[model samples]
Target chain A: MTGESLHLESVAGLVRGLAERRFSSEAVTRHFLDRIARLDARLNSIVTVTAETALDQAREADGRIARGQPRPLEGVPLLHKDIFCTQGVRTACGSRMLDNFVSPYDATVVSRLRAAGAVMLGKANMDEFAMGSSNETSFYGPVRNPWDTERVPGGSSGGSAAAVAARLTPAATGTDTGGSIRQPAALCGITGLKPTYGRVSRWGMIAFASSLDQAGPMAVSAEDCAHLLRAMAGFDERDSTSMNRPVPDYVAALEAPVDGLRVGLPREWFGEGLDAGVAEVVESAVAVLRELGAEVREVSLPHVGLSVPAYYVVAPAEASSNLARYDGVRFGYRCKDPRDLHDLYVRSRSEGFGAEVKRRILIGTYALSAGYYDAYYRKAQQIRRLIREDFLRAFETVDVLAGPTSPTPAFRIGERTRDPVSMYLSDVNTIAANLAGLPALSMPAGFTAGLPVGLQLVGRDFDEGRLLGVAHRFQQATDWHRRVPPGFE
Target chain B: MSLSDEQVSAIAELARLSVPRDALRGLAQELSAILDFVAQMNAVDTSGVEPMAHPQDVPQRLRPDEVTETIDRARYQAVAPAVSHGLYLVPRVIE
Candidate 1:
């Protein structure tokens, strides 16, 4: 196969290509690495390109194929978001604190993918410590949107989204605390899924918010995401919160018909704050689902408006506690000199964390502090229950909720950096799903003013198969997912 | 609801993070804005609502009292900034 065709192939296509011996794993891996070398400078999507290690893994996969011992993902090259700990490789998590900290072990997601024979093509950049809405917070640099270089790629999975959108890699792993995976996938015109809170093990993935974080796949199509999710999700004893349920074959579930499916459009999602262009695109996508014999209706989720505010409080409160481990003690960064442990702790953290991270830590500390805990932290948790209840009420009547994934398409870089509240609102539509711990995904709907728009589908907890099946059917009806970025082609 | 610079300093101290004197003013303004934004939650009455911590209501799973694996102290400490005699080195506390 030509290099152009090689880069354009989906994860499933690449798997088949390797199995059929149409292209060797080494050739495929080399093709992607070469693309990153030539194109990534424009996007700043990758933090590290593990060329040597990837070639080694690809060669091993080829040997296995030669011996008729092929594995599930056998030789498919993919990038992991820097948040996942890659054994013996620098897993920076887009922060200066861990820039020098090479992980001693692989994250559960990483280990599972490796077990499935997927080749790692280095780590993708992200918002520092997975905190920001745009990729601008990365200690490395911002990951630019492939569609327009001046615009931002929604983050903290921005790098993974950009990499997959540009075809630099066939697939990449992304973790969503509050819309990290789906928001970026929306802005960058790719497919991303955030499984139910406990669906994927978070044993080695760095904690942003313990209750909210989930790792999922970002790829060009839902079919590809299904193939990757089958390899990535399952119960693990290490993560106490990991759900003990049988892993469903997501790929096989994609064949289920969307006929007679119930899709609800939350009235709150279509109200103010949703860009008109994005709403129109989402409505058109819903029309396609309706034509496929699915039932569509407007559902009320009144409490969802408070999701952003509640999320801001709850996530930061958890983050402050989780990040306290970064003091100048064990691993990570340390200050040059210190008068005492107090100075060491303060100075090391002040120096290591970025502005956005520090702001969150302060907010979290104040919220969880002695006198204000009930007003902020506890109040947010109560509001969280209300938000979850709203979704539960909606799900009682509908199998899935469909809407616009992001409020707008990719905004210009530095657009909302000065106003932190504005930045927080970018996640308004997607945060409720995380709060509810439901399965949700974003797929390319169409383009608006030369930029791509995404249609989001959310489902009841552990109903990822239904969400993927719905998205797969949509992609079949439209060519939006197949549309590559301008210069990327 | 706006936080003063002094309050910001107190919160920073509580979090064990040092903020430069110049950055404190701007930081205080940002924090105050965020607080005002989140204060919108107070408008609704959550009189009997239980605070949800975990998304799923699952009881903590207890494991048998057995060592899962041997400790690799050296391998774990390899990433530490300072280590001496198999222990992590820190500023002298008692001194």
Candidate 2:
């Protein structure tokens, strides 16, 4: 098969081609690496391209397939967001602090995918330390949306979403703390899943917010996401918060019928902040579910409006603690010269961190500070319980919640850069899922103007299998996920 | 609560980050605005709520006391900014 045919092939399709020797894995890997070299300069979606290692892995995969012994995901090429540490590869986390840092250990997600015979194309860029809603905050430079080069791809997994949408590789890994994966996947018009927290091990995935952070897949379709998630999800003893439950056969679960699935549409999601075009697109997507013989109902997650504000407090508070390890004396960037220990600590951090990261650190430090802990951190945690309870209550009536993944589709690159509040509000529809540690998937609903709108489906904890089944059936009925950008096509 | 410049600086110091002289005022203003937004939680009565630190509320798993890792000092220190005589070289803290 030629490079264009390979690029358009889904993960399942690529695996079949490899098994049938239609094309060698090395050829597939080269096709994507060549595309990254030729086209990534325009999108700025990649940080490091591991051409030699990828070629080496691809050759090994070809050997496995030729020997009639192959792993489930053998020979599929994919990119990992820079946040996951790939041993001996630069794991910058899209920050200047770790710009020169090469990890000595592979993240569990990276190693697991490698064991499954997946070849890593490269490390995709992201918002600095996974802190921003738009890709504009990356130290490497903003990742331009493939849909419109002038617009953002949505972040902090913006690069991953863009790469998958443009078919730079079949799939990529993305982490969602506060809508990083789902929001970007929606804006870029691809299938992205943020599995329930603890569903996937967090070992060696750089921590942004421990409680809310989850590693999952971004791919061209829900079927592809199901295959990738099957390989990526499992318990690990290394990650303290990793759940000990057995991972369900996600790919097998995708075939389950959604004939009587109860879909919930939270009234709060359609309130003031939602764009009219986005709401219309999401409703039409719901109508597709209705056509699938699923019952859709209006449910109330009354505390949903507080998601952004509560997320800002809780996420940053945990981030301050998680990011404190980058103190310059250890690994990461340091100031050229330091006057004293205090100066070393302060100057190294100030010089190394970007504006958004520093702002979050300061806010987190203040929230966790002695006198203000109850008012900020504790109260935010209490709000988190209320949000979780709201989901619990709604789940009693519905199997899953559906809404717009983002308030609007892709905005211009620099539109919300100066105003942090506005950027925080963009995550309104998606943050509640992260807060409740629920599984959420964002798939292309339709287009608004010229950009894609994402219809988000959120499932109860550990119910990702059911969520994927519903998404897979919807995808079978619609063609939105098949649409590619004008230039990318 | 809105923060003053001094308060912002104090928070920065505690967090071990330095705020540049010119940027302090802007940082303070931005942080205060964020704090005001987060203050919306105060309106909710969390009178009998338990603060959630982890999603699952699972207890921290403990293992048998044992040395699980071998010391690879060279590899560990390879990414450090400054190291000398098998020690990380930091500015002198004591006179």
Per-candidate Cα lDDT values, in order, are 0.94, 0.92
- Candidate 1, residue A33: how far the Cα is off, in Å: 0.4
Give the interface RMSD of each candidate.
1.0, 1.1
Q: Output the TM-score of candidate 2.
A: 0.99
| Pairs with backbone N, CA or C atoms under 3 Å apart (clashes), candidate 2 | none
* Candidate 2 Cα outliers beyond 4 Å, as residue runs: none
Question: What shift in Å separates residue A207 of candidate 2 from its native position after superposition?
Answer: 0.8
Candidate 1 residues lying further than 4 Å off, grouped into runs, are: none
Question: What overall lDDT, based on C-alpha atoms, would model 2 receive against the true structure?
Answer: 0.92
Scoring each candidate complex against the real one, what DockQ results? 0.85, 0.81
Assess every candidate by TM-score: 0.99, 0.99
Kept native contacts, as fractions per model, are 0.87, 0.82
How far residue A146's Cα lies from its native spot in candidate 2, in Å, is 0.3
Per-residue lDDT of candidate 2, residues A1-489 (tens digit): 576668998999999999999999999999988888888988999999999999999999999999999999998899999999998999999899999899989999999999999999999999999999989889999999999999999999999999999889899999999899999999999999999999999999999999899999999999999999999999898998889899999989999988898989899988887889998999899999999999999999988878889999999999999989988998999998899888888888998999999999999999999998888888888999999999999999999999999989899989998889999988989999999899999999999998999999999889999988899999999999999998787
- Tally clashing residue pairs in candidate 1: 0
